[model samples]
Target: MNLPKRNSEDGRYYLMTPDAREKLQPLFDRCIRDAIDGKITRPDSLYPPVVVSSEGAPFGVHYLAMDWAEAQRAETFNVEQAVAFSENLRRLSRWGEIDHYLLGVLERELQKKYFVVTGREDDHRWNREYSLKPGIRAEDVPEPLLRFACYVAVSYKVYGLDFQYLDTNYLLGLVEKVRPNMVKKLKENGTGRLPLNLQKRKKEHFTASANDAFAVIRISAKDCTEECYSEVLNYLCELLSQEDFPRSYAVEFKGPEKKYLSITGLPKKGINQLCACAVQYPSLQSLLERYARLAMRQYERYTNLDDEQCALPGSFAVFALGMLGQPWRQLVWDYLGLCDDEHSRLQEKFLREYVKQFGFTADTVPIFVRGVLSMQSMKYSKDYAAWMANAESLGALLDAKARLSEIVPSGFSSDDDDEDDEPTDETEAGPEEVLQYAWETVCYVIWGKASAKRGLKVVETAPEELKERYRQIFE
Candidate 1:
């Protein structure tokens, strides 16, 4: 069979066809599925270990299709395995974008001995010879490609690492290196408005402004050549023109091999003018107020849209009200009417937490009760039902103007109530442990009033009428 057969009409992922699926079904069912599925439970920030069934598993080649988005590979493939490798290189140079790092790792593990192109652009005899690896089944492709593709499918879970944390001492050292050069330049070309004179105003100004100044300086460093002193001066002048930069600027002088010669400082009246401008307008408070209003409107738009599959809108609404302290009571009420499905229930639970946190009393009990109870059609676990029962009672107290502080049992909110005293032993508990915990904590709050109204434990399984109501909504 051809390697990397296009199984789906629209897919970025490598496909496993029905024939290939059946051929590999025993291996998947007996060995791979449980192991990989367990690994999938880990947080998205980590990459799961790659899996290969056997040591002698064949290598599969995947060619870039013309219809696919032009891939920008971060690295190149050096073909040291086959004569066809040279042609493969010629073809890939026109088609494939390779990640050299990932490819290098894969190459070592796979130990490339043949080069095969999955698709046809040439009918050369050498192409057919490498199309299928010897001793491999007609239904099977190479094991390495399959493993790589599976990893690619779930790679979206990886979180972007923050790279913006720069050490203060390291930054100041750069400033120390650059300051002396600026002073020398100042003597050669002094001006009242230049940053060369600004350093004399305050020593703290240099340290205070180094971070912003470094951002500009780093760009100049990268662009600086063997003889770019004039470029450095231009960068310093540009920093002076920006309102955000402080009173001082520094430049690092370069010696003959582009070695560091010295650092010089320049001072100007930039900070004084900045202070004068601050007095003319109190824009920070005004701008913050304006931004808050804009954020609220944007959140409103997010809540109203149904295009996204996730319950992000409900979370956004809760976050807006909880974190930003938005006074959008009507928006929260409107959000209640919109949440009617299993997926939205999670967001509704988050909203309930925000509602209770902000001390929404009996006046808001009806909203919580109706919103949470409306998801009865969803396949929420029995534990979730139990949580809903307890939550309903709290809402009932709010409805009857009862004091929650008096009703909540003593020690329930105490630190000793934590259940995470024991370390988690299972590496692959699936996501159920998290879901059950969410239901018990957040969802339990919203169902409190509904529990009292029905005279049933919130944790009890849903009654038939509730299920029917859910069906009716969908119908």
Candidate 2:
């Protein structure tokens, strides 16, 4: 559909309705007054471009990106150069002696081109391309002059100003005074208007459903010292007391301390669990994800960066997969109260469907299965030799299973422990070990000690051949 074009004479978005014309007349007069005072001699000075489009009318303004020629001319030292320089200075974060030199250049140019009289009044109306004028051809106007006009047009479009007649000298002075202070004012007030043509797309991915909300909780040692198991457990207890969740969640660690930090709650319980989770998992992956999303949003808001350089992490897909495979899986089981038989059947079904969807080789299946098992077994700390051998063995087993059409048995289930089962060792595992085990399992359903007094759960269904291969490497 062809959208109505904005009029270039006034900064509004529609063709000149009678009411709009009435509003614009005074602004045009003012612009002419300013132009005369600033000694702008061209007849075009009395007919400055409009900044908006009226119904059935053409757009009032347009923009070109800052070019090299414009940038160079903005640096000149003369009256006109000074005006252009001052305008640029107003936009810069930091301007110094060089900026002052250019401002002087613009002032001189304005005096030469314009006729400055204290109270002379001039008025006219013309229709042409918003940026062009009869006597003031594009070739005759320096790049700095064009750039300055463009900036004025842009400001008018954003702020709804009448530019047909402006006090150019007064504006020049205002630019000079505010140039150094613009940054401070922006930080303090944040009142600048955005360009009128800018359109923001509504966020489409987020759902208002409570289940869609996720929280990341972070836990840390009260002091920066190494965390103890007791302290971590105490913190977790305290957090649980503060937050109620409809479902379980996952946590992760960040930084060298490995002190428990952040927790991410599933959708239903996010609001209730977030703060407490933060207390337990200080370096929570959910917190990281939130920050990452924010950074990505900021990057998208500004079109200055390329896809590769955007703040979104490269490992996001892998991290998401881990979340789905492990903690999310556990949450489903716990929430649905799946029995051992049901859980095993579901796992087999899932594997078969996944293999079919991906057209994966049988050899690839064992390797993938082993990786999943290792993730579930909390064996990430195993040495390189052990990891490699386990992988190779798993690959071979997957091949055998594929060829035989054998369904692998369920490996480890977290709910299998008997109430009477107890650990033989009395000494508590180090805080690092406890936290690491907890964190990994939360990421990938790895089996580990449920508590200091509980023994570890070994994954049962990953296959004997793969287990033997891992043992040989470790031994």
Scored by TM-score, the top model is 1
Stretches of candidate 2 exceeding 4 Å from the true structure: 1-181, 190-294, 297-385, 391-475
- My TM-score estimates for the predictions, one after another, are 0.23, 0.21
Query: Mind giving the per-residue lDDT tens digits that candidate 1 earns over 1-475?
Result: 2333323332212334566766544443322222222221111111111122232112112222211112212133222211122123212121112222233433333323323334365853223223324654423433333233222211111110122122222222222232434323323433223354332321211212122322212222322232233333233444545454422122222222232101111111222122122222333323222322322211122211222222322233233332233444544544544443322444444444444454444445444444443333323234433433333444443333223222221111111112445422222344444333323332334343433423244324546545433222112
Looking at model 2, report the run of 10 residues with the lowest lDDT sum: 296-305
| Candidate 2 C-alpha lDDT tens digits along 1-475 | 2543344333233333575666544443333233323322111101121221212222121111111123334336233543343333222111221223333334444323432333323431121112223464434445454335333422322222144224332333333332425323332322233221111111121111111011122332333222332333333333333322111222222222332112221122222122233334444544433422322210011111122211111112122322234433322222112212211112222333333343334433442343333222223222222232345444554344333212222222222123355422211344344334323332232122321222122323335656553232212
Native-vs-model 2 lDDT?
0.28
Top candidate (lDDT): 1
* Deviation from native of the Cα of residue 354 in model 1, angstroms: 4.7
lDDT per model, in order? 0.30, 0.28
